[model samples]
Target: MSNNFKGGRGRRKERGPRTNDQIRIPECRLMSDEEQYGVVSIDKAREIAEELGVDLIEIAPTAKPPVVKLMDYGKFKYEQQKKAAEAKKKQAKVQLKEIQLRPNIEAHDLETKLKKAYKFLENGDKVKFVMQFRGREMAYKDMGKEKFESILAGVCEEASAAIESPIKMMGNRIITIVAPVKKK
Candidate 1:
């Protein structure tokens, strides 16, 4: 028998600033919110941070002399998380909405599906049109393609939609993806 499981230690951990007692460099370039302290011994920097009731955080450990800063580590982390949250809130998530149809769909049903696809595009959701062929219906691939193209053209003309993926066959189904055009 062979064991294929790997230990969790093989995974890489996120790197963060070394704060307070975790900073072990003997000397480093120190900076504070008010001014820069040039190059100074770690003990001197720690003394200044301790006098100001702030933590000594190593910001650039890869620098020639290492760069440390005197700041409230908790406050710094909070501000970083707040910025990240703000960015995430401003980002838009595009969802994919799939609409299934058949090659022999009636004109009225096709119109309804097109209307639904337009609504999806207006709401900033991508649309995927899929038509599956059954048995003998697969022989008329050109008809399926024509139907898919006609529906897509109608939807694109009605709404400001652009094709993200062209019509392609997946197994027994023909599918295409469309997305809303970005406003300048």
Candidate 2:
């Protein structure tokens, strides 16, 4: 196989749209919020932009005549960045935090780990409870299942959380996921 097929690292950075004097096209389709001046010469577009104290930005370079817009490029760029940041901020990230335990866990130790799980649930994060068993301990899978169920119930009692995934035995370990309930 070719090296390029395996995620090549030589990709060039994408260039943004041309603005103002960078637009060398003889004519372009000019558009604005107030009005659109069909296909006009570059000089005419520049003249209009100069009169409005704005920039002539080439929006769709691939279109016939290359669609251009007359607007304050600085303000347009700022608004685009602000919108991107707001979208990023509104993105939901569901993180899964894990708590590991053995089938023969003590009561005090179970309480401590349960507190940690509750804290994770309260913070709107998913909690994965994993109980691992060794060779002989594998015989007591029921005890591990019962312990995990009880712990999940206790942690979800105060905080409104739901089981995201059901308990399943994976080799020597059993795992389950619990996520905080969504508020309307």
Candidate 3:
């Protein structure tokens, strides 16, 4: 086999913002932490960057004359990644949790299901209740609907949940969604 395979997964190039010699513009609006150099030739900018021991980074390539900044490119990249990670950590991820039910479920069993659903809602997750019907159980869809409605009411009242989707019948199942009410 050859060392290079056609269309194989190869080492990908870094596609980040242009820096140093990658900037092809003739002139740019230069800026730095200590002062703004206004407009200057690319060569002058590269010289200043070299004197300051930092990379000449093109921040706004679309701006008039294109804006460039003198800074440590590696440090800037690290800080950007750090901010992104912090944002992801603070973001709330809402997951959809499904709870299955049967028309003939006993009272205690239904209560157990509601407890689990409540736990999920309390943890910033959406709950989808599915009332499944099998064989002759389809005939008792009305009974299933009533039971589902009662379950929804109890959940909303006791768990501070709001009905996200009204109850609907889908083929062999009755479905509804509930989400925890946001606290002010």
Best by TM-score: 3
Decreasing lDDT order of the candidates: 3, 1, 2
Judged by lDDT relative to the true structure, which candidate is superior, 1 or 2?
1
lDDT of 3 at 143: 83
Q: Write the per-residue lDDT of candidate 1 for residues 1-184, one digit (tens) a residue.
A: 5595565866545467778877788899999999999999999998999899999888889998999988998998998899999999999999999999998889899888888988999999999989989989899989888978988888887898899997899989999999999988
Query: What would the per-residue lDDT of candidate 2 be over residues 1-184, giving only the tens digit for each residue?
Result: 5755545587545466789988999999999989989999999999999999999988999999899999999888888899999999999887899999999999999878888888888878999989999989999999888987887787777678988888898999989898999888
Is 1 or 3 the stronger prediction by lDDT? 3
User: Over the stretch 53-77, how does candidate 3's per-residue lDDT look in tens digits?
Assistant: 9999888999999999999999989
In candidate 3, stretches whose alpha carbon ends up further than 4 angstroms from where it belongs are 1-14
Which of candidates 1 and 3 is the stronger one according to TM-score? 3
Q: After superposition, how far is residue 143 of candidate 1 from its true place, in Å?
A: 2.2
lDDT of each: 0.89, 0.88, 0.92
Clashes by residue pair, model 3: none
Per-candidate TM-scores read 0.84, 0.77, 0.89
lDDT of model 2 at position 102: 92
Task: State the weakest 10-residue window (summed lDDT) of model 3.
Answer: 5-14
Pairs with backbone N, CA or C atoms under 3 Å apart (clashes), candidate 1: none
TM value for model 2: 0.77
